[model samples]
Target: MRIAFIILLTLFYSCRGVSQSFEGAWKGDLAVPTGSLPLHFSLQKGDTWTGTMRSPSQTRLDFKLNVIEVAGDSIHLQSAALGMSYKGRISADGEHVEGTFRQGNYTAPLRLGRYDSTQTVKRPQEPVAPFPYNVKEVTFENTASEVTLAGTLTQPKAPGKYPALILVSGSGPQNRNSELEGHKPFEVLADYLTRQGVVVLRYDDRGVAQSTGNFLQSNIGDFSRDALAGLRFLKAQATVDSTRVGMIGHSEGGLISLLLAGQHAPDLKFIVSLAGPSLPIDSLMVLQLYHVGKSQGMSEKQLAKVRPINRKNFEVVKSDLPAPKAMTQLLENMKSVGGASGTLRKELQVMLLEPYRYFMRIDPVPFIQKINIPLYAAFGEKDVQVPAKENQESLVANLAGNPQSRIKTYANLNHLLQPAKTGGLQEYYTIETTIDPTLLKDIADWIKGL
Candidate 1:
């Protein structure tokens, strides 16, 4: 995960006559309109006060509150890299730091207390040790790429030729657990599925955790090859019913399933998609950006200025122009429209541009139309990243030729399939439930039916 560099940490330093006991761990939740973000601060006292802040849920939030000032009861910390300044008043009891977190024209109330890891929301469904199912730490080869992938294969103890599912993760580098904010959604899902007479393969992404190969160089197709390798490995196993093997993927993983289904090889019995985009990636990305900005209360006028710049950038990538020429055109267009300024922003743009070029060009309609296997596609009604309405409409429209396709939209669910009000990515970490129970049951039953 790339660091946002836009810091949201608030800390408190000791004022003269205010207790030295105030200088330890401090934590706060920055409540945005979408959801709450947890901030952890570690303070050390030397000749001066120094501290680092961490956003446990997001890796992009590793920032130090180096510039700190303490005078009387007031504390000031500035991180220009993060484009924010925090000014808070430490309570006399040295318990809380009440402050206003300011960045640009936006200001929000921030309250920091003695740091507590327990403030993290609970995930009740996460599995514990001594599980009823047997779990094996297995390693398999993505024979096409010569990369060895490591993952946990979970199956029921009494299993005999059990139906199996390969769990594919979303975008970004993720572990076998698919861990985020102390929640292991994949672990929970795998456990739930395995307990219900289904075997599951949940692996780390390429170059992630124990897995090998350079993840930065891989596109969606590379990941699908890895997943297909998992399927082949499972098929050879005596305990797995090769004829009933299916692939279930989340987000980009879901898109990978579509890519694999078109192959019609290894005889994929079924495929399940969770919040997969049905439209072309370029169109989906445009809507995704718009939805996210709107959810965060961005004005339509502001969107009008930004949307055209985003479209032009994608167009340049899609064009026949050389990389240098495309980049020049993209930057010139951004400058002309008064959008995406600064050295940091431009550097990030260039860095991310190449990695998504293949994804941006993927046309899923052809893939869906060619798939002969039974398909179960689920979308969260409130998902902004892959809007439920647009994706579902496209899925039904494109897969109309496929008589075995099943498409559904879950109300009040977000991109993560957690029950949500706003469907914002920010809300993902805050919600206690990882994947909704009904959704899990729906997926399991569909796979079983196939």
Candidate 2:
């Protein structure tokens, strides 16, 4: 998921004064490689000009720009939580901002003009009203955490008890539909699968959308409990077959499904890992960063330099030594690569926090190897994050003796499983199709086989 996307910080800023023409709102499109991300910034000129940023494509509808510093006509706004920063100059007329938006190693051109109401993107794949199935908004409580998880449950209209499948969303705080860019793949998948006679339960991640919880404080075990709670809810329903309840997880959700299979093997009949990481997250992250960086046109030299730094950072988190000792080693490693700055140092500490630390240290292979339930895992050939070849190989090797496991990879598909020319994250929004038909068929066919 994105540690950068949801870093919340309470910064105290002194209102310098509302003396400039830069007051009010300015809105524009940040042209990323996949599609345009509509960004709305409301610059309130005060003692220290404050601003809030809104990206219609993102889950957080309104976000306080963690750091926005203005020096004369020069403007600098940053959201360290999102690994995003903007540096530009306000036009002489104070009606425009021309700048570059940077996230990690990715950068895109952004131009803002007079503030306009947030615009909506067309998502044809999103399931509309009058769904063919019986769709209802439901909520269930995770007894251990006492957190309410809200979700949509869709059962075939026939009313007979049917096989149930819980849809677990991937990284980041996603709504019921696992929405990203302009696509609602989970909704589309739910609609299709439900129509094919399966009950589908898709829900928002804890602390996301209608759910309640602190995502920052949650880790894999916390999420595993949520998935298990959803499974319990689905199994207890009269419309679902308790004996045939299964889970289909995408990306991180896939890993969660495996965890469920390992911990709640009796309750979970089967699982599907769609582009799920089979290796330790740290290993997967390096490959992901490299692929994404390469797609963004990062030169080989730059990649070579940064990749090692990132790998070392992960190693620091995974080291078995004492926490302070590990951190000292990490700083030394960072200095050797000229990356030991205050920001990077602080970022390293955040990485050691629960979420990042879990990803770095947790290895799913053992859980997967212990999984006794049937498992169906598939990967997109063109996927950059959690690439197909290596992940598939690991999964296959780990499940060597499990005949119930099915692993396959599809060509020309990106992480989202849409037929993509280039499997870059930037291409996510531009593609019209939510998920490729073949991917759907692969899942449906496997489920039918069970």
Give candidates' CA RMSD values in order: 8.4, 7.5
User: What TM value does model 1 have?
Assistant: 0.77
Q: Report the C-alpha lDDT of model 2 over 30-95, residue by residue, as the tens digit.
A: 533212346778877777768788765446567778888878777888886667899877776666
* Top-scoring candidate (TM-score): 2
- Off-target runs (Cα >4 Å) in candidate 1 are 1-118, 351-353, 400-403
lDDT of 2 at 78: 89
lDDT computed for candidate 1: 0.73
In order, the Cα lDDT scores of the candidates are 0.73, 0.75
lDDT of 1 by residue, 16-35 (tens): 22523447788776633212
Q: What is the TM-score (0 to 1) of candidate 2?
A: 0.79
Most lDDT-accurate candidate: 2
Candidate 2: where is the Cα deviation over 4 Å? 1-122, 320-325, 400-404
